[model samples]
Target: MNLPDTFHLIGGDALKTGTGGSLEHVNPATGESSTLELAGADEVDAAVAAAREAFGVWSGLAPMARRYLLQQLARRINESAADLSALSTYESGMPVVYAAQMAAVGPAEWFDYYAGWADKLNGEVIGAWDFNYTVPEPYGVVAAIVPFNGPVWEIGMKAAPALAAGNTVVIKPPELAPYSSILFGRLCLEAGIPPGVVNVVLSGPDGTGALVSHPDVDKISFTGSAGTARKILAAAAANLTPVVLELGGKSGVLICDDADVDSAVGAVAQFAIAQNAGQICTSPNRVLAQLGVYDEVVEKLAAVAGGFVVGDPLSESTQVGPVISVASADRIVGMVGEGVSAGTARVVTGGSRLDGPGAFVAPTVLADVATDSRLAGEEIFGPVATVSRVADDDEAVAVANGVDAGLAAYVFSRDISRCHTLAKRLRSGSVSINGLGNHMIYSPFGGKGASGYGREGGRAGIEEFLSVKSVSAQL
Candidate 1:
């Protein structure tokens, strides 16, 4: 993978010294590490200023022109999928197979999806009274803070909509996995997105704080932990800037008695548990199975989970790979081991680290986990899941809603009415019936309660970067 020693964003060249510290990035698949220069307050100010300067010009453009440029970026993203996928595996420990679909090619879909929205936006005229209309205007400068788990995907999620709405952006990438995002900045310029329309600042929390707190920044959209969101909220409060946040989740996977057994197990064990080392917010790790299917689901899920071998992420045949870092692996292992030792849960399959290099945590499925325990309630951003038995659909909904998070829930059942009923009762942002028609390219993805607020897909997402101006004239 081609890596840059210093991060220089397009309009605002950001190769500068930050409040000094180690900017070393470690490859989770190996122990090797490299360093990049951090952006300080100066870089933040420059990037913000550039974004502010460019916003008027970008917003003033004919909508079709913006659409054409966004589509060009989409084409570039598709062309560069392979290199970006490798970066995801190297930097975030995302397995290469899934990285291609998610961290790489997936962004192309986002750009295309939002690109179409650029020219389609329309204002409403209130014909009941005087000729009054509401015009949707883009917020000036949007600050997009993306997480390490899925850099390109979230970058596309945040930036595409902002740009579609005619807003300029300054992005702050996670310190651990900044490679793909840094490359993305160059892609913008190559795709004919004018300089200052998209800028990236490389820094830790200090530099991020500088960008979030900047007076000129009009909007902030972040995807990370709730704790970090609190700090960002505090900073944005000083400027009273509106923010769109997508935070952590301990999403539930509900398998009803009448559901297709193999399909449910496969979605949970094969996709949700194994993908990205379960680093995504919608991991669907807190599994609640109805009593009739609980034992069978547990047995089948164990076999499927155990079948995956933890190894190098670069290997094509490897099903499971290392997590983002050794620290995360250790935490996930401890969460399971401690729960099992405390008699709160029982391990159904692999639960310990492999005796090899890399930050490998074997795929784990813990059965009979206490609903109130950490393994069930907390967000374990690793390849670990906790299963519990529910007496009925009501109990399943209750147990699923018991957690503080409400990002997503997976419900499996042949009975459509029962599925809708449970989906209604379950407190989640989006409910997937039989694992379809939800959280997709056009779905509005977000969470409620502790999962944070604001949607990140489709038209709702683009509206996040826009403000409404009511225009009326006396006739």
Candidate 2:
């Protein structure tokens, strides 16, 4: 992958320097290192000022005219899919093919998906005696804080809808893997986006805090860990600026007593890791297998864990790759060790770090993990599986809904009625009856409690960047 001359794009220019010191990354596979300057308060102020200036011109354009520009961006993204996918793999150590599907193809699709909505934003008319209708208008400057795990897709997820709703954006990308998102900002310019209409800043916490707290930024959309979300929320509260957050989850994969053992095992095995080495926010971290099949489920899961091909992410044949950084890998392993030492979990298969050059952890399965234990309850963003037994359907439902998060859940059962009943009881935003890790872009995706509030994807995503005004004129 060819590195761009610089990583930050502000007001239609690629900047080579920033206020803070440089941020560096060593290639997970090769240990080769690279650095990009970390944008700071001054940079944040400039990006916000740029977006604030561009808002009037951008929002004033005819909806269809805005659509035309966005369509051009989508086309360009599709043409450069190969380069984008390669860049993601180089930065995040994700499987190249997975990167192509999840990150590369996603931005183009999101742009096209929302482009149609540009002209279709409708407001309802209500009247009994006099004429009255609602108008949905852009929220001015929108600050989008994107996570490192799925940097490319998260940009499209937050920026496309915000742009389609007539709002200008200042994207704050994490320093870990900001390359693709920075490129995205350049793509906007290449596709005819006016200067100051869209900006990207490669920054760490200090800059991010500034962006979220800036009074000129009317709205903020964030996708990241729950811990980070809290910090952003605290800053936004000062201005009372509304925010939309999509955070991590310890999602449950519940296998009913009637479920086909093989199929249930397959869903847990694949979705638990999802080929991104389980770094996904909605990856099923805990498995609630019915007691009738718990033993068999654990046995098969262990076998599947051992079968994963852990190697270089750039290779097409590699099924599992390194986690993003050495620190992340160490945290994951330390969590597992803590669980074992507490006597709440036992490793049934692979557990230790692999003898390799990159930050690789062995794909692991911990059988009979206590349902109430930290190992089963917390979000473990690694290539590890925690399996526990559920006495019956009631217990499974209770355990599934027990966590503070409710982003997603997966259930497998031969009985159709059981699937329907459990779907209603499950607190998750999206529940798969007999599937795993399947997300529909057109559906409303979000959570109820600790998973954070507000929604993204489909028309719901577009609305997050808008505010409604009720206009009533005497007829």
Candidate 3:
């Protein structure tokens, strides 16, 4: 597959110079690599400047006009869905079908959803001494730093809402998988989005720092690990710039004794790891099973994991693909080793890395995991699941909430009332009952603790890029 070698900047320009350095873009599926230019501080400055320049014009446009442009951009994205999916698969090793459906179509749908909210961004008319009203105004230029996993979707999550709220954006796509983001930028221009309204800068942490610290950048939206969020928070603090962060998660799935063991195995446990090779931040890293059905759940989970089709991401039949990089793979393996050494967990099905060229690991299931073990507490961004037995519902909830990150959680139970009660008690940003889906384009998704703050979808998402102002007049 042919790919652009230069960084995508404002006005649809792809420039190789003015970048700090270059890095090889490695295909995790094949271990093949290609050199790609990395945007430097200068390019970041240029992108931020361009966004700042465009904010006045873009934000000044009528809400309906902005809505129309966003709809047009969504149409362009849908038109190029197939290409975007293939590019995502090539860069991130995501299964082709999943990439097409999730990354491509998902983002397109988000743009369309956010478009509908453009002209509907209303404030409030308060009762005061005079005619008092409020207005939600855009925060000028927004800097969006997206993670490697689900790059296109994250871009749309940040950009769609920002644009709908009448803000221009400078996006910093992750270095690991940036091809699709650049293509999206090109599509923006094709859809008649004004030059400098949407800029894509391909860079690593250095460029990200520069972009966040730039004076022109008014708001920062980021999705990545909590460690990175700390640094970004520090940098944004310098300018007192408002930030919205969606960080890492070690989410848990609680399997009740009365739950359907088969559904819990297939949907809750298996899908968590097999999907995106468990790179998802909200993947069910820990499973708390009631003691009454703990053995059955573990057996079924292990069997389902062992049955996953681990192979080429491009293959139609493949269910699981390689991790993003060798370093990530090694980290996953080390985590597993630590669990085994602690004697708190035992590998049930698959554990070691596959003997091949790609950075692949077998869909592994660890049973009898101690709640305090590293494997149970840490976010393992690989196809690995740890099952821990709990005595009762109280213990289940306790184990599920006993973590630094509380982004998403899952509960499997046949009783609706019980599910609702548990869902209310779970200390997670999102709680799914009898399922695995966490995020939707129209739902307000975010976390409470180390998982970070601020919602990223629906009306709440668009408001994140907006600032509230009150207007009063004498009647």
Ten-residue region with minimum lDDT total, candidate 3: 10-19
| Per-residue accuracy of model 3 over 132-179 as CA lDDT, tens digit each | 999999999999999899998998899999999999999898889988
lDDT (C-alpha) at residue 278 in model 2: 87
TM-score of each: 0.98, 0.98, 0.98
Local accuracy by lDDT, each model = 0.87, 0.86, 0.88
Best to worst by lDDT, what's the order? 3, 1, 2
At residue 95, give the lDDT of candidate 1: 79
Model 1 RMSD vs true structure: 1.3
* Model 1 misplacement above 4 A: 10-21
Give lDDT tens digits, candidate 2, residues 224-307.
888999999999999999999888788888888888888877777776764789888788768999988889989998888789
Tell me the RMSD of model 2 versus the true structure: 1.2
lDDT of 3: 0.88
- Winner on lDDT (1 vs 2): 1
List, in order, the clash count of every candidate structure. 0, 0, 0
